[model samples]
Target: MVNILPAKEIYLQGNEHALLLLHSFTSHTRDMKKVAAKLHEEGYTCYAPLYRGHGNAPEQLLQYNVYDWWQDVMNAYQFLLDEGYQKISVIGISIGGIFTLKLAQLEQLEQIIVLSVPVEKEPEQLKQRIMDYAYNYKNIEGKSALQISNEIEPFTNMPLDSFIAFQHFIKDTMLHLNKITIPIAIFYGERDEDVYAQSAETIYQQVQSSKKKLKGFANSKHLMTLGRDQEDIMKEMMEFLRMNNGDLTQ
Candidate 1:
């Protein structure tokens, strides 16, 4: 039986190696729970934080923006630091992956694991996609496009101003990719529907990190963290952590 308490951050105590996990936008920390458990089993401490306006009703998300989400990431990182863990690793899925890359530019991380991150899309392209997604819910009874997007969407009912926040983060991260020197492991599913698989190659080519690797999963999708290859993903992540000399000083 699953525990259905109110949504909250997950903190698992383990060895010296600490992992700060971030989930996708509109998603709660629960999405990272399984991966956190796997890492904890390997003697690694893990923390997964719920971003503002998440883990509750979908309508709550409309009040937040990318900055709020990023602040959540920073807070989680600081919490781990306060816990006296020196060596830290970061992992994120989708938008979470984007935040992890951005965070690496600002902090010293042992390594970063990115799964199914989207490439920066052109302005018109993004606008059209968002609009198309909104159209799907426009006709649903008692469910406006925004409300529906808040809950389940390829595009959320996120306002233009809020949506632009994410675009800004993506643009900023792209500019600073050269600043990320830590080892990075990137995973992309070949059949991913949300993000282009080519994004993995683009990221691999732009990062200044000498120790970076990109791997493709033949049978996974955009939600690779919760997909069919989760076990394989976890195995690969464990190997990556080992190869990067993660401080598992238990």
Candidate 2:
């Protein structure tokens, strides 16, 4: 059995307006910490949860389904609500973006910011990514070459139910985009692949939010927050929030 690696879940107390940040697939909350910290510096409460089965062995990832992650998202949102933050927004990237859209469908969110989302189906690529994660993760764990191959070989061609469920969840979220009426800002990196750019356009066109903005950073890519245009994108994000009742100087 793979032991769970320790993860750092961040919560910075600042103001009544809270921001919930979600990370990508095969990632931890650290990916969103920079954005959360940036917002916290401006007097905003920020919480980024480390999802279950993540920050651990890649094999452990296969043990959890999309349902597990959804519960994590719900719990994170509920934590904010219980903290007396009536107004809450979400910023999600990749799989986190998927959750943000799904959350908007049922939750009373103030607004949403989605980055580098893959709204379309990507089962094959996802499967390959899982395999790659497993290989790289074992290497990081200091496992020998024989051990890594032995561990990954069993699941290389096997049918993974978690990934199938994840794809279904994405498709399910796409059908419910019209349910979201809050303001939305979708951003992508010009340096990223065509899939992300197309996904951004799809989200912009499909969400029922009347106030939606779609922007691309010239020097950024899929992981926009860590790209060269990170500062510029964050500035634009703040501006978008300020325009949409995010002037939290209160």
TM-score of each: 0.84, 0.93
User: In lDDT terms, which candidate is top?
Assistant: 2
Per-residue error for 53 in candidate 2, Å, reads: 0.9
What is the per-residue lDDT of model 1 for residues 48-119, given as tens digits with 9 covering 90 to 100? Answer: 989987765434555677788888899889998998998899999988899999999999899999998877
Residues 60-172, model 2: lDDT tens digits: 77777779999999999999999899989999988999999999999899889999998866677778877887888888778889888899986597575667777889999
Candidate 2 whole-model C-alpha lDDT, 0 to 1: 0.86
The models' CA-based lDDT, in order, is: 0.80, 0.86
- Which residue pairs of candidate 2 clash? none
Model 1 scores a C-alpha lDDT of: 0.80
The Cα RMSD in angstroms, rounded to one decimal, for candidate 2 relative to the true structure is 2.3
Residue-level error in angstroms, candidate 1, position 159? 3.5
Residue 31: error of model 2 in Å? Answer: 1.2
